[model samples]
Target: MKKRFWIAIPIMAFGLGWPLLAQENPTEPQPQHAQAQAQPAVSAPDVKSPGTPQLDAADLEAWLDGYMSGALEQGDVAGAVVSVVKDGRPLFAKGYGYRDVASKLPMDAAQTLVRIGSTSKLFTWTAVMQLVEQGKLDLDADVNTYLDFTIPERDGGPVTMNDLMTHRGGFEEGLKEILITDPAKFITTEKYLKDHMRPRIFPVGKVPAYSNYGTALAGYIVERLSGEPFDDYIERHILGPLHMERSTFRQPLPEKFQDNVSLGYMSASQPPQAFEMITSAPAGSMSATADDMANFMIAHLQQGRFGDARILKAETARLMYQPSAPHEPGFTTMAHGFFSGPINGKRLIGHGGDTIWFHTDMNLIPEEGVGFFVSFNSRGKNEAVYGMRERFVEGFMDRYFPDKGNEPLPPAIQSAQADAQALAGKYRSSRRIDTAFLKLIYTLQQSTVIANEDGTISFASEPGTKYRETAPGMWRDPNSEGALHVSTVDGQLTITNSKNPVSDMQRVPLAESAGLNSFILFGSIAVILLALVAWPLSWWCRRLYGQTLGLTGRDLVAYRLSRLLMVGDMIYLLGWYMALQPLFQMQFDGFGTALDPLLFTLQAGALVPLIGVGVGLWNAWLTVRSDRHVMAKAGSVLFAAALCGVAWVAFIGGLMSFTLEY
Candidate 1:
């Protein structure tokens, strides 16, 4: 969970927006081939309600029973907990599915506790705002003022409290041990932040990268200022006052509650997993029951008052909901750690979280005075939890607050084709790592915009859902509140969407395109492999017929050296892949200190490619100058060029770096 929350690398940070890799969908959004929409796919509800349906305990339960029962079973979700509050009252709270499938123990909303991943950040943000209200912290002041350590400045400026809350810290994603199996290796919040102070990739408050480290930093600051451990302060101030007895930020949970925590599973049929240990605790470490979560949600909906308790002043609670100034027109913005999305013609403020087997979403409709929280124990097939939750949100909105959408026929605009053509390209999410090998995630996750023949744009992130140019540079999803606003920021095209306010997609320039990078990497490796394999195969064939060698003297020496260098390049790549590949493959349970020495050795291997480039150039020059066959000369030149590609890919991808932070 710390992976985005590494604090979960996904916005889905909490994929928690990762393990910022798991997602609201509880799985990375893989790029899929799609057909251009003659009509847009269902991104939201289409049923036009004649009038608002009455929402009460009985109807709400009936609605949930009708929808969730089939959804959980059809999706293969093991179990779930759902809690909803209206007018500061829990209108509905229930648990569906088994808490323990092996024992067939049914889930209980008040008894079963689930880890509420990145949604835990709301408490950290609330803690910061509490200090702000007391004049103990400055939102605009440098965060360094409150900490013992320092954060280096970049594009945005000195990191500020406001910046962390808005998730604009721009720290590069790093560290693999988001969820460690061993409790003995757990690190303190302060220690984790100090050690993993991810390099600032964006200027102060420039881009929102959904930082778990940044949020954890705020929690550390709260610990420092409040003169208490983060967990203790939370227990004394927030949880105690809200009467959320079932909630606790303690890792592994307190012994008393351990038995009550529901087991997590990748699938219902799979074995239950160990407790996910998030050392960066404050970022996404909280377990609570549906009843307790409902109470916490009610506090936010009622301006921080729960029963007789007050966690925040009414104004402070109100302040927390203020959306950041819009960077793109109609694009929802992150506000004080809340994903302030304007859905169904009303502002919904909340956050979503994922921790491998468990996925959850907590949202509050401030204007409507209602809050909804849901959690699924299993990711289910194809991360179908995303669709289930989406269906719930849209269905609820349609029943309670329907939006009178436009006519079915897409509007005809003369410039739609031009706009579509111009916008057609790949865009990388700002949440990706800029200074480490984790940036490789960008290659697979980069969102592509394909221009459809019908003058619409198909966003790869929302496959099969065509977005028409609703305005000049803005495209609206016909089915949902999702909007993609394309604008030029410092001459670079930035695509900001309403669905994910925490991160935006910047147009991937040709030099940085994943397609180009992959081509260079694979094509170069293939060139080296060809020569390496042919050298011995040619000798074997010659010996079979007892043929005499054609080349002699300097040609023989240069050719031998070229083949040797190619072997070195291959060895260099293989060693590095062995060292770093697991970090990519294992997102949920990251590797520990065992990889340090191996990584150091791999760093030393960077020299092999450097030397190969020089030797390859000489080989190319000798063969081109000599009377070698045309194919041989071409192969030599290609070999040289392959070494050059390796060097370029290594430099830009940070594979050659000595730093082992990630």
Candidate 2:
């Protein structure tokens, strides 16, 4: 669901007999000349003839080989395997580079077992669709009926299967909060639903927020209805039927196939870490070879038939290719699993996958009966894979609709220095109240630019430690993309694209500011301490102050602590607000700045009662403390809570040092 640059053939053109249109003439094309330009028209060639105008076999091989080699040269990949199939026949299948760089082992086509990432979701969806075809599940039925746990509804209506498939289930983005931390714990669809039964972020069946949890839930539904494990069901129903013997939910690299496996490598900044299998297998924990993937693509292109065997009915496959939801403009359609889009007017369905150490792409042109799969074992920002797909599609289109040759490159337009400077002014979005600073930062340590770019930028922080820009105005320190934005306005810098106008961009001297450090250190320590102590204090407060507080000591403690914590949180929030305020008129409220330490301390204090209640309750249950020994119980709780809070705060503070701005 994370949007990436996509390259696929058109579905409408490929399906239902839509005539292919030639690429727009480059000499007289559209106004936008930011990136790629359109190609010129070519005459169509006869498809029935065996010999036609297409990339020569030798040239095609060289192109693919050059692509793989270039990827390695650019340090975007350590090794890779590529496979091209046309008309259900293997045009070429080969591997390039080393599988084990340290051991100096060569990679082979048959042995690669790379983490295919979210592409695994396609297989999961395929299995679910197969079940749908079997009359085992209904897309419109309430998913909660099959779930073992309650799925909280939005507006008192349970989410349906269709919502899950289309990612319109109204579930919050649960990956960072739930999945990444401990996926297995939330494995059961029922448990996941129960834990996340809050109101929808957007109306169901409206906006689509890509959710791995939603797809994982669908996988679970398959398991429950099929009476088989999610992985086994796919293997038996889909993979097995397609004769994809090497593909598996588990690591596909066995000893026999180890020789051919490509060694996945991260950039030197992000050295290869030991691979840990994700417990959320359905979302992105599977491995397969180019040979196996080619077969799968071929089956889809052939209307769900592999040779004489029909893996899925043609009508069902057609439904899978139908547009299920509206995507951002330029995107063809987001079908059940595949993305339906255009490539020179030819319909194409495909998906791309990016994991820790791999990038993959698969595209199929059903009308031309051609498909290709390419995977890289390293990660970088070069758009070669996408470019390769475009070229391949161009070749295909030229063969089928020869009149549509490669589009001419757009005329280069150099922005005048004065104009460029004029456009350099700080600009901010009018949608939000946050401001992201985008300027060059010169510190005693190093000089760096925070300039906002259209695409990703990487920072080499330390050896094997890299930061990648995951979103506009935001960079991911290590792996996952964090939500952050930056904008420019009249040469002034603002952080988030807040609606509020920012003052002037005043440079802050980078030094050890006590207030900033305290906010960083104490704010974190207090939050952790409070979080640790709040619950326990709630219980003890229920017993001690419950009668006096007009509620259980626990309830009173929870309520009071929550309120105070909320206040402290508000102070910090206000400080951030002031920091983003317009410079000229900005006034850091004395009260807000002054209360920083107090708020921190109060946050720590609130934890005391909470911890006291926890220890008291635990000790009382275990008979470790007598009723007369309330003070001792409270002390014990305080000690334990303080230790946990300190430890947690330390960890969080370390993380903040790399991520947060003072």
Candidate 3:
């Protein structure tokens, strides 16, 4: 087990809060059971559709009322705003529930503002495109060309704007100090970029690891090229033109818009927390109302011009909406800033976002000149919010654009059982913590991709979903028609839903192969606890019997020292766990330098158990030489062995490493 200690440490980490980290398959456009013959592939906004009845306004309103009212009550979500735009006009824009529950102020879709989170990246990307249209920026050029400080080339390749836009820049995901509670600590974009440059874990343009840092770096480049502050550049070139008067990217928002800001809650029952200050503001910080967002969406849907304001030229806008990376057949691809996928046979480009306590989604059906936006004020950790978003979109699509049916694909692969077996295993997301005890979460919660004896792969994390090999190394969900492309890259088993592999779940070594560490850990804890209780009882029993048969001197001292070591080990584990408990409850931005002292103490204290290993071994040798029973000698060896296993597990788990930087 000691020799196998190095197997589990993966150099990866993920965001603490949502900032577009999870990559879900795009919604299927055609129903799986539809019998219509397959039609030729269609580009976005131009998919041919059998004409259907237009959505009735009154019926839509009634349906929304029923769904929103029920969802708000059942999910315990505080409030929400819904906006729908079609044919360059606002079809619906309204708020449901309260904006400020204590004051009983109702939400106002045109006035009340909520944090838009990662969806704010659209504005940053839009600004970049505007500059590119003017030849002030280059999408394919090395980003270092515009930066004051050079970004070191990885594998002889410089990261380009295209790589950043497509989320294939290879930077490891970041979390620490990314979100700060205090506005004062929210440093400038340049400083934030410099202080938190992540290590590149994948080669450029190879993987799709969602990165807030990469987005922020793009924003910084925009600032440098435009010779203006990022917020100012966006306001002048994007927001101001679109007449989004109620939207802002500033933290602690401008005084006039502050009162309209909706409070964020963990749940409807929980008290509201203060507005968070995103350290990477360009990635996930923007506050806007439903109407303001509607206006912005209209601009994108209409080829960059909204009313009299124009953000990007037609060609640039078209380029921005196009896929930046390759994708699986029948799957969505990464656009410049948006995620483009099919819905009800209609091509849609959209973005979804989440702050600690707010969740939102925005999608545009360009051909229909329609866009939908929904945002909830509560985080709703039970994921009721996510369910609501998916259901709402699906229902809306089904009603307005019911599948005309499509030609079914060819027969499923029925002879790939061997291939399926080869791919079966427990796999962890590449986006995970490497240097912190948080890494244990991935180890324990990795997805189990099982190869069924039947020629299908069972995705255990999402039960009821299975895949069949549609190609040599490609699998497709027969029901949804979504695809999963797999291959071995650099000896790692990589699985991707789209063109770029987002996660590589290396085959985990069997527990037995890894020195049987899991069993050793369990046995060690059990043995040490028993010894802690039994040692004291043994001493008292001897005193009661007035026996002097036990050994003294070095043996007694070593025995006493071993017991003290167990006390230290217990204190370290328990103390560390207790300290981390309150942290999980605190706001995402609330963790920072304040947590260093306790973490350092716990790390330093874990070494005490290593001392126990030495003391236990000494005691074991003396106990065997003494006039002790055979059972007593066996117990000594077991206790000493347990001490070694305990120390090894702790060390490998990073419980003993001292680093406050996370």
Q: What TM-score does each of the candidates earn?
A: 0.89, 0.54, 0.86
Please state the error at residue 244 of candidate 3 in Å: 0.5
Model 1 worst lDDT window (10 residues): 30-39
Residue 362 miss distance in model 3 (angstroms): 0.8
| Local accuracy of candidate 1 as per-residue lDDT tens digits, 310-346 | 7899999888888754556445677777877566667
The lDDT per prediction is 0.75, 0.49, 0.71
lDDT of 2 by residue, 1-662 (tens): 11122321110000000000112223421212111112111223325445454644565676666655665656544566667666555566677766566765555555455666667777888887888899988888898888887665566366887777666676543321122223233234444444444335445665444555676788888889999977778888877766676677753234554444455565422345344244446766667777678778767776777765667898998898787764433345567766666554456677666544555667777766677777666543343434433344454445544433334322212432222233232221111111111011111112122322432322222223222333333333332111123344233343321111111122222332223333444554464456556756766877886543343555445445544443444344344334334222212122223334533443344344344334434533432333435754454454344333333332322211221111
Compute the lDDT for candidate 3: 0.71
Q: Which digits, one per residue and each the tens of the lDDT, describe model 3 over residues 1-662?
A: 00110011121111222111111124412112111012111223534345744555576677778888888878877788888877666667778877777876677777788987778888888988988999999899999888888775677388999888877887766556767767776777678788767767778887666777888999999888889988888889887877787888887678887777899887777788878777778887899988789888777877887776678898999999988887766566778977787765777787777777777778888877778898888855574665666677777777777665545655566657888888887665655555665444443456678887667897785667677787788887666635677777667777876422334455555541223555666688888899898978888888999976365788879878877887776676677666556346655564566666787787777778788789889989988888889998998888888788778777665566566654
Q: After superposition, how far is residue 496 of candidate 1 from its true place, in Å?
A: 0.8
Error of 3 at 143 (Å): 2.3
State the displacement of the C-alpha of residue 478, model 3, in Å, after optimal TM-score superposition: 2.3
Off by over 4 Å in 1: 1-12, 15-52, 327-329, 407-416, 443-445, 461-463
Q: Backbone collision count in every prediction?
A: 36, 56, 8
Better of 1 and 2 by lDDT: 1
